[model samples]
Target: MSNDMLRSFFLGGFECSSHRRADGVRLDLLRTTTHDVLAGSDYRQLQNCGISTVRDGLRWHLIEVSPGQYDWSSFLPMLRGAAECQTEVIWDLCHYGWPDHLDIWSPEFVSSFSRFAAAAAELIRSETGRSGLYCPVNEMSFWAWAGGDSEKINPCATGRGAELKRQLVRAAIAATDEIRKVDPQARFITAEPLINVSGGSGDQAWQTEAENYRLSQFEATDLLTGCLEPELGGRIDNIDFIGLNFYPDNQWYLGGSTIPLGHHSYRPLSDMLVEAYERYRRPLVISETGAEGSAAPAWMHYVCSEVEDALRRGVPIKGICLYPVLDYPGWENDRTCEVGLLGTPGPGGERQVHHRLLDEMRRYGHLSDLARKAGSFADA
Candidate 1:
């Protein structure tokens, strides 16, 4: 696919995490933010900011209610809304949650996921006359760490992070294959966290461990590209876009506090982007990036500046997505996280726009236009 595949250079990511919390309450962020009910208007809001492309999700638990049966009732409206608004979306099939009936460790989980993905692809093709872009699984590494290693979320276990990560990779590869069978033109994205880990202490062992931990960030994508584990049915073609989700808290000392942006240990986002592009040689996207209230505008400026620098250095970054474009309730608590350009919906389904972030978006929208022209030159 060309670098211009996405409709816009900037994108809005609707928070669609559907993971169960420690209290056994399954959290659906899309519903929490009311984006599911107001998806059409939500898309229009982004469009007004010149963001025609978006990152959205299909809640697997809601769609695959039973073993073989599928229900799109919870998802169709959002899909139709995007279509109605003339929005381009990269749909995430599994966003950290699954149906309660399936054991995440079982072989059945992989098979069921593949089948569901194929069904979703079929539905998209039928409704929109295009297979579209999809992210088969979101943040496998983080999910494994939170849910399997740390007991912070569902399928809570201890000392099984690696095992869970491999299982998610298998499921992702299976979903890609199945989706391809249904929609041959479909493209896939691997939306993983881009992180930096620094050894705060001078100990050699600490530095070594920190380096290993940092390298582990690429494990999921490496497996998908068949670079590390070929037995999982991974291939180079499985991922067309490398989606890196970065935020202020992404970089940190291995066992200490976060390394603030200006800290010497803090790696520039441009350098990380180039490193990833060189490793995978695939088009990249800032799949998710944003900051909470009061910090949003400055954060966008920083990210856009870094992205432009990376672009100048020959990195093919397709876009930067402002994640959770609509503020939503936090997973661990019900408090609103003021991290989006749009606030919670009102009685009439209207959302309050964060003028500062909107101003920054207007200022940086030209970056996409410039990148598109440059891409045309490169293509020629």
Candidate 2:
């Protein structure tokens, strides 16, 4: 399917993660980064950078203060700001955390999430006079591994990663169905991590283990497409696009260090993109990708180069989103992570632009414009 519905091929994503820490402290990145209060200025900044599309989230825990009741006060401003700026937003319905009153293991969790999605669809259409684009559950595979298996965040359970993954897939499917009932034109994106794992040594058993670990990255996506678990009400039509979240550390060796970018075992991201496209026959997006400090510019350059290569190979690569477009505090240590095009917001929510990275983006934007004009990657 084509992703031409988006207004821009380049997008900015605010750090809207609302997951809780292992210590049971809820982490509201929106508040810590002051984006909750500065969304208007933030969208305006994206427009200045030539980005008319964005990926952001609505805090489900904050919106549904109580069951069957919602307080749109938290999300209304951001939604209106996007509309006013003519920015297209692909909203994340559930980033990581959910209302504490419901048990994630219970059936009520799926039903409640579906209901909330339905309500959100209605609200967005009523306000914007258009159907919404959504990511029902963000990074289900990572969420399962971190929160369910490793106990790194909320619902911090151990030894239940597979179960948690199935639950999340079920919720996503239910949410998609409910949203379609409200607005049949609504589209859903499945944003999952894109990773590669290789064997570090010559041991045969270790090689098999590494390969198995590598392939496990597709479990969540496979389930969603009914390739693994059809009993969960999954089908091919459940997802409209596949959003792959890649980063510098996405490739590694089993139980070993990260593979350097130029290492022999480091697979080119273009190949990974092609593999994903062939496997699902769906258009893809670089949903979340960025780096911190001095490495940010180079990382952006690499991703864009790889994406262009994939596009040239007939892969339906749609867009590239510079995630967490604004600098924010780290989840573990509260240290400032300088990983965005814009630095920390000042007292008035003004941010210092990373001129070098912005320049690279602009350079790539010009190339993309030329490509579009030439009818190259036009459908992509």
Candidate 3:
């Protein structure tokens, strides 16, 4: 773990999603989090907390104003900010935002995305002299279900989850291929929500359905690694890390019902981590996890304990990232979600740090050190 590429045992993440809403209004989380305006200060805060590694994103819609041309204006500040703060960033090349002109299902989509990814990689390498770590297309499964099947975004391909998933997987594969050509040392972290589903009634049919639903979580990663579809050009080299995003309500029973945490029916997060690591045989990260307001500290406690348990079980748990480290406006109504360790900004771009949450994180930071020190070498 000495040369851990993440550069930190504990990590923080900025909410950089730039997805357009159902009403056609794009939500720039970076703006809401004020990271767009205060990235340097945000990175300094992370460093002050001993978190040198972080997750940020590229706003594809803003960057690629035209087909192949790129506008780095929106993202350049954050790039400079990270360097100024001496932070290491894992950039999300596409966080649910693409150029308005590109049809998601068109052949041009994959090529355009691949080109953007390559250019982004080149920029990062040229600035940082590192082959960049990336989550090329974050949460493909979730995006497909929320944005593709539902009317959460443009294209509104209702009931076309499978088709959308296939297209997204193709784009991710192509993006990865293109990135490697530009930065051969690049590493990828494929993030998808990790969940536990149960048959609440315990009926045979529901049980089978629940199992299948749970397995569906790995669709994108499976496609990338060539486990299910070799035609996508997936291979061992395509995957470097497995990022399992967890939250309070991640586990649930089928039919949109949630299984309460600590309930017998609710599988522990530690078990889920082991399952992913054993299945993928790659270093794992809790790519995102946090709760809003009052539950924040307690949620971190629970997550830290589960991650510790997983590490003891020989899982190569690399790092735990506190996502949305800064609070942002909710996508549904622009109402503020007080889920970050830091709160809303003032005229000077200063956010109020939640002392309680900061204390909890610092307290758990010690445990993370031990967890990393004892991780399994096979995945490392």
Candidate 4:
């Protein structure tokens, strides 16, 4: 674990997705959470809580209105806000949304995306003089399953999971290549669902099926680094950092049952981190990890403890990002999901802090330093 890698040991993220639902209803999470309007204040709040690094997004569909045109009107202000607040951001170029004219499966899609990524990188470099940190396209495996196979979101095509995964991997690789051409010092983060699937029933056949599901989690990164798909224009250098998005329901039985984090059958998250490190030998980050309301503090405690355990075992964990640091409406139904350290915004744009989660964050910050101190003493 290195504090020098990011602006803060703990990072915060805003939910900035612009995905369209299966029924053609498009979502603008930034708008719902009011981050679009209050970027400066929101970032300022995070900084006050000791998090100067954040994850944010640019709505590609809104910006890339036409084939070759990009209107930075929507994203520029947020970038400026981050600069104003002295926040370091890992910008998500595409968070499950694209322009209407683009077909994700077509070759033109890859070309258009590459152009967009390069232009975006150049824009950031010119506007802020920062060597960019970006997740080119967020959660490829999750997107493929949720949108492509299950028909939950845009470009909803059923039974095309494998095809969609390949297309996304191709587009990401193309974007990475072009982005580097524009900004060679840029760092790329490949974030995908990190899950462990199992057969609650101990039948050998069901166990094998569960293993297959679990292994699919690595497809995106493997494809990016050319381990899975060498023909898809992947190269080893494409992998800079490994980002894993883990949550409560991440580990489950293939038959739709969950393995709660602390249950006897639940696998230790530190073990999962070790597995990932052994696979790629890359620096890791918990790109997204948070739970709603009262569960937030406990969930964060579990994650942070596992992170420390991973650190003790020599895993190069960069940092952990608390995703959606602002409360937002649920995607499926418009119910308020009481996630984030900050509550819903008020008339004057003030937010109430979740004292529980904040306490957990502070405690862990103290403990991380204590662990390091103890390790140094042991070495001495």
Candidate 5:
């Protein structure tokens, strides 16, 4: 089979609402029925678009309230519907929100999360009869960057305090381990934003900060891989797979007087993948990769070609996922709708993709196939 034949594409699920508020932010709580409609529509769209797998979010806060009180009424139907459609679901257990009642610093938080994970795993396995993929938490570093450092989300904290960071990591590890107990065959993908930062001349301090930011992505992965550096070992364990989330604007640089040779431009997504491959040699997946606005198609093709190139060179990349099938409402600065593959519906309700750009992607499918063949031949 060709490389393109072996390679698969996944789409991110969940188009829940999150609007900016006066005092803080408000998450438009998506009920089970609403999710069912969205998930069904997304699955059909993905199937028609040639995507094979779907990455869906299962928010912890939405299912369990206090402790053992579980609410499957909302998510169960959607799961069954996806299964019926023969779509592979990479279940994301916690995207960003926690039960509003649980404190990040409390032991109860960890215990509660563990219980939730085990129960969820059991339910999913029982219903699907497959060891479904699970991401106990999505983008741990990004969560810290937003909630802990930037104070953008709930329980927003600020400053250099390591407590919030530590707690989040702990919760993730606890949840991962608990889920493993219930479904020993479950696979994990620790998805984090592959942020690339740059700096200019006279910005030595900023350059150093940028380097630290890049290193932090690997740091979180290391924790999940159970190889945390001596200073960071109290938090995680080995992950089954490496889930990388990359975007066009995920790279930026600070202007300064003294610039390093490679410090001027953002590192390309290919370079980031090569770095991860060199470090772990695990089966990798671009869990989330897309562009905002009219560049969506071009961005998709660019990222897909990069992944194809990596495959040709023998990278163990398993999949590529376009995030959020629908143009979600209330994106950060209202940019969510623009990142979607299909342009946002207008007053007439028409959705379209740039045909020329999509044709470019189709052309490269052959290159992707060649790469897959190379990898297979090498393995043989």
Candidate 6:
């Protein structure tokens, strides 16, 4: 791959959730904690390790409590700090939850979110000027699966079939449209998980189901980009770039030979990038790609190398992001996943594993070493 085409490394930032206290809110503190620590530890680690961009999601639910009321006190400072650190950010507006009052299917919810998105775009532009990226909604397919099909998040409506998918698409459209209105030049990287499924007869069925699940994500993007059949008045021109979030277990199966099989099983990140490129024909980014536990660094290496492979294959891959710079609490379970480059925080704010993955990232020279080795062999 040419040097001009190799995009910068993307590091994940903190993710906040509810569990508020009167002092402020739990999620807000979580963001603050990450900002402080990154400013101290992770920022230098990223710079020393050769990462140039940072990716973090700003929860709509946390920032906006009521319809018109806004709270920038907690989020703005973090963005400013990131900018000062010379790290570019891909701001994710909505991940999985909404403000306590907004219903996904409600007109009020749609209109309110549109206004919120526009306001956010304006603020980001006004604050950062022209050097800002936005992801109005993160993981549309995951949201559909969790809230609509799987009953995981708030307003957990499940088994609703296409209705749930439609709701997600509408929400994305509303958010994207409003953001574009505020900053017409705003670049967007819409992050959605790319789940690969495998197994036997039951596994095949599961894979089929998983593919359908995956379709919801691309479908929303396709609809937004005018690539799919118009489901909601042809509002498909809103998507600019594609952000793919893939995890190790994101590729799974539910039945038959409980043990999964196939080259798809633990797919190399290259294949995922190629899939997105083939489907969308636009610039693609690995928005949130990482593994859990001590394997995180090795996984980061493998995924980043795969990204280089895809670039060599002529895929218009834009960037690779190691999501969640700090190891925050997981939603699936309370245990710390330790997926970040800097290890998870220990009890009472102690750093446990220092530079566990970040050090490895430096050892490999940010995966550029691997890419050079591969290129040399290809030339030979």
On lDDT, the candidate that comes out on top is 1
**Model 2 spans > 4 angstroms off:** 1-5, 366-380
What do the candidate models score in CA lDDT, each in turn? Answer: 0.90, 0.88, 0.85, 0.87, 0.66, 0.63
In candidate 6, the residue pairs with backbone N, CA or C atoms under 3 Å apart (3 or more residues apart, or in different chains) clash, namely 12-324, 12-325, 223-236, 224-236, 225-236
In terms of lDDT, model 1 sits at 0.90
Residue 360 of model 4: what lDDT? 94
Instruction: Please tell me which model should have the higher lDDT, number 4 or number 6.
Output: 4
- Model 4, global lDDT: 0.87
lDDT of 5 at 172: 72
Candidate 6: segments with Cα more than 4 A from true spot: 1-7, 17-45, 199-217, 233-237, 254-266, 344-356, 363-380
lDDT of 5 by residue, 58-91 (tens): 6676688666798986688778877888787877
Candidate 5 at 179: error in angstroms? 1.3
Q: What TM-score, to 2 decimals, does candidate 5 have?
A: 0.84
Q: What's the alpha carbon RMSD for model 3? A: 1.9
True-structure lDDT of candidate 6? 0.63
Task: Encode model 2's per-residue lDDT on 249-292: one tens digit a residue.
Answer: 99998988999998899999989998998899877888999999
Distance (Å) between predicted and true CA of 131, model 5?
Answer: 0.7
Q: Where is the poorest 10-residue window by lDDT in model 5?
A: 1-10
Error of 5 at 163 (Å): 2.7
**Cα displacement (Å) at residue 267, model 1:** 0.7
Q: Which portions of model 4 miss their true places by more than 4 Å?
A: 1-4, 366-380
**Could you give candidate 6's per-residue lDDT for residues 289-342 as a string of tens digits?**
777777787777777667777767766656667776666665544566666666
Candidate 1, run of 10 with poorest lDDT: 371-380
Q: Which ten residues in a row have the lowest lDDT in candidate 4?
A: 371-380
* Candidate 1 residue-wise lDDT, 192-249, digit = tens: 9999999987599999999999999999999999999899888889999899999999
Displacement of the residue 40 alpha carbon in candidate 3, Å: 0.7
- Residue pair clashes in candidate 1: none
